[model samples]
Target chain A: MGISVLRVENLIKRYESGFALDIPHLEFQSGRIYGLVGPNGAGKTTLLNLLNLLEEPTEGEMFFEERRFTDLDPLDIRRKMTMVMENPFLFHTTVFKNITAGLKCRSVDKKMWPAMSKEALRTVGLKGFENRYAPALSRGETQRVAIARALVLKPEVLFLDEPFTNIRQRDIDLFEKLTKTINQEYQTTIIFTTHDLPQAHRLSDEVISLVDGRIIEGSIENLFEGTVEEIDGTQSVKISPKISVSVITEKRGKVNISIAPREIILSHGAIISSARNSFKGIIRKIQMEGQTVIVNISVDEEVEFTALITETSFKNMGLPIDSEIYLTFKSTSVTIF
Target chain B: MDYILEGLGNALKMIVSLDSEMAEIVFVSVKISTISIILATLAGVPLGFYVAIRDFWGKRAAITILNTLMALPTVVIGLLIYSFISRRGPLGVLGLLYTPWAMIIGQTILAFPIVAALSLSATQGIDKRVEKTALTLGANNLQTALFILMEGKFALFSAIIAGFGRVFAEVGVSMMLGGNIRGFTRNITTAIAFETGKGEFALGIALGMILLTVAFSINILFHYFQKKRM
Candidate 1:
């Protein structure tokens, strides 16, 4: 969207065993919330570490604002960024001291520390916790204090590695607003990793899943094989016996296309749309994951597609396993990869 | 049994009266052991932190060597220092033998390995995210090291307290190095040993009681801080 603030070219990190992380080319735009989603051991933490400058890439180059990361001063780059790890470890001091740790390191005026710390605390719902010892805090409170600690620095880029693991949604909503402020007010770029698929879709404009060191390119992929048909003025893919979906590709013959489950719109019945891809089906199964519902639809006896939706939407729809529904998606949302 | 009862009664009376000679012995012991532990802390804390964060070859062996040194006997260290600082020994012109400074140096060596070794263990036991979080929060190498040291402060202090316990109760180093001179180099442990040998069980039992109390107090304080940390 804007000029790239951070970019990695041919990044590869090798641990003692396993493929840690491998990214051919990646760019992070300024002031954008990007979510990295993957399962455990999917190199999400490795990429987050590389982006946070916590570890050196075993191979390849990283650039910040078009300058090579190795060429720039590491301290300077790190001073402009911060990371919040899963199960945040707070210092064995008062909450106020923990929050202002980075500021003290930068030699910020001691007088300004209290105000900054209070503001960060207020932003993270920790207004009355200044005098509390860090180790005495609950897990959720410790996490909020950690976020407050990072926010006190007003870092340019924030990296979070599984920060919301086992976190409650109430705090998550407040955290969402706080992150929005960081992006809107300070123009901070944020990169966070999560195994929660719906969270990635809800929080980020762009989401990438790294599975075994390969980026999944989109969220909740539902791959479909279809025969390309060119008619009047557009091309369409016939995916199943009853589903003929309009697509924007020029390729002909048998081909494959992948569409993100989040990109699909579900309705109780057929809905009118101009983009031209829709299928009437029955709900095959309902699977509830963290904060999300996966609705499996059987368009035909031989073909089924997964649809990603929020729990609220699924509840509001009052849909059951055998409920009839219609699925619609834009041709543009279909990715060939 | 009557003599033991008399010794106990006389020792309590001496303690309650705040006897000056007994006070000097305790004071000398505290001063020397405190200085020794302080010196060990200054050197060993940084060494422990450095060893914890680095990944150089032979790190495991080096840590093993430090842990082995934690078991070093007080007399072994005293014998080594005595051989070097004795009148016929090399560089004996300084007259450090038979002085409190020699006692401090010997105790410091005895405590240094324990402090460093326990510090290493404490640091290794911390959650691994601590250092990474510090680095990501803009801490430079030294600052990051300090951050971790602060995080592990409770355990680190416990290590120091344990070292102090050792120095406070040890007799071999103080007796060998300080020559047990009255009013100048005599400490609680050496005075207790000397009085016991002279059939003066009253002072001996009294000083031994103080040593046990001090060691128990140190352990209590360490456990207090450790529990608070947890």
Candidate 2:
């Protein structure tokens, strides 16, 4: 198996302006696209700069491919890793010169220039614009040129800072297609910072969400799908399924009644007092399946509850299209955070 | 005004005819300015590069000194050099005063600070990423510095032009150091001074016209390089 490609440990950076980044630990294995999702000023760019060694960290260690990377020469780090900044700077030269700047710096084989340029341009769909002036390119085209320059170096790892930011939504498809091709073809380990949640969901194999310079939710899929319930009367909230018995929020009187379609228990009468906040609502509608029943209740004209009960339960209650039934849930099942 | 017209006509006629006397003065001006610019660039460009790139102790003091030197009065410099090279001074053994060499030395000293200070600003003005990018590309420190200098070549040229323009138009240094020696040490500015003092208005105006042309050419060259960089 391949070695873990990049590892960061207890990275901390503080500015005199009172902003700080305190990431305890983060790692990325080879051959995966790790999406770094956070709000603006959430330290995403700061983390990228630290990883790229553009700025020195205030404290902590970092490693690349099992080698100790802290205190390494920044240029050496840059040789193997490339970052495409949100707003890229194009050199005052033709596209070809800017793309070839890195190769020339490293004194790579001069004979390979044509081939490398061709491949890099093709990778980013910029094949015909080789001689164009860098300053004259549109924002999207300039970004592609920047990508081509970074990719042409054939860096082992690539960090993109909001690569899709200024591109129009309609052109996102084309951009995504190019990204997929580059990832598949180069097998380059990729880490990118973006606030586009849907883009992260579609492009990343794993998403790490950051808040206030801390990792709040990490690696849990469908995390937002968990129901958010405001605790009765406090500044607290909890997430849980509807049928939980301990659904009591920290506050006194408010709790959300949630039930998974599969977890709901339905009855024709108010049968038990052990569960709190049971409500009587008519089945306003019934949708039958092979062995399941979907009962939609109009708790109010606006609020509703949907429960999936077995056909047996529905039959025994003689639950027809307009039958009244009771919905029950315990408070203990609530998840308080 | 009529003398000015006649001087302009003579200036055009001299340029058209490639007259040797006029040629000699123009040649001397270009020679002194070019040599001084080269010396200043060699001595000052790297100094500026170092000052801009490094964060050593006394850096602020050094920058402040350089900035102060940038505004140093040309006549003051001329007087200082004049004292050191005079007949009764320590260097009188050489008898080298009132020559092109003395003028060259004065002009070089006059221009060095301008080039060095401006070069420093140019280097300092480049994006920080450009430096980091060069280093990350596996370039050693010297190589990285050279790369940045190449990228900032236009700014460097501007610095050199500003230096030459300062030196070439300077009358104080040329007149004092070279003693306005006719046919040998007489540059455009010194010649203009000499002709005007001797009541040769036509000759002084002709020299002034030539000075303008020379200054114009330098400006055109500076802008061309700037445009290429952009």
**What DockQ does each listed candidate score?**
0.58, 0.28
- Give residue B45's lDDT in candidate 2 (0 to 100): 98
**iRMS of each prediction:** 0.9, 2.6
Q: Cα miss at B67, model 1 (Å)?
A: 2.2
Per-residue lDDT of model 1, residues A89-196, tens digit only: 888789998898899889999999999999988888789899999888988899889988998899878888887777787877767677777788778899999887
List, residue by residue over A1-337, the lDDT tens digit for candidate 2: 3468888899899999888899899888887888888778778888888888778889998898877785566567778988887877777679988888889878989898878988899888889778999989998888889889889988888888888888876556776776677778998888888886557767887787765576654321212223434545423223333322335454433422334445456777787767664667777878775677667776544346667678887777787766677776554432332
What 10-residue stretch in candidate 1 chain A is worst by lDDT? A216-225
lDDT, model 2, position A53? 78
DockQ score for model 1: 0.58
lDDT of 1 by residue, B5-96 (tens): 99999999888998888999999999999999999999987788779878899999999999999989999999999999998889598889
Where model 1 places Cα greater than 4 Å from the true spot, the runs are A218-259, A262-305, A308-319, A322-337
Which residues of candidate 2, in runs, are more than 4 Å off? A70-74, A218-337, B1-9, B47-65, B87-96, B120-129, B132-140, B143-147, B222-230
**C-alpha lDDT (0 to 100) for residue A145 of candidate 1:** 92
TM-score of chain A of 1: 0.72
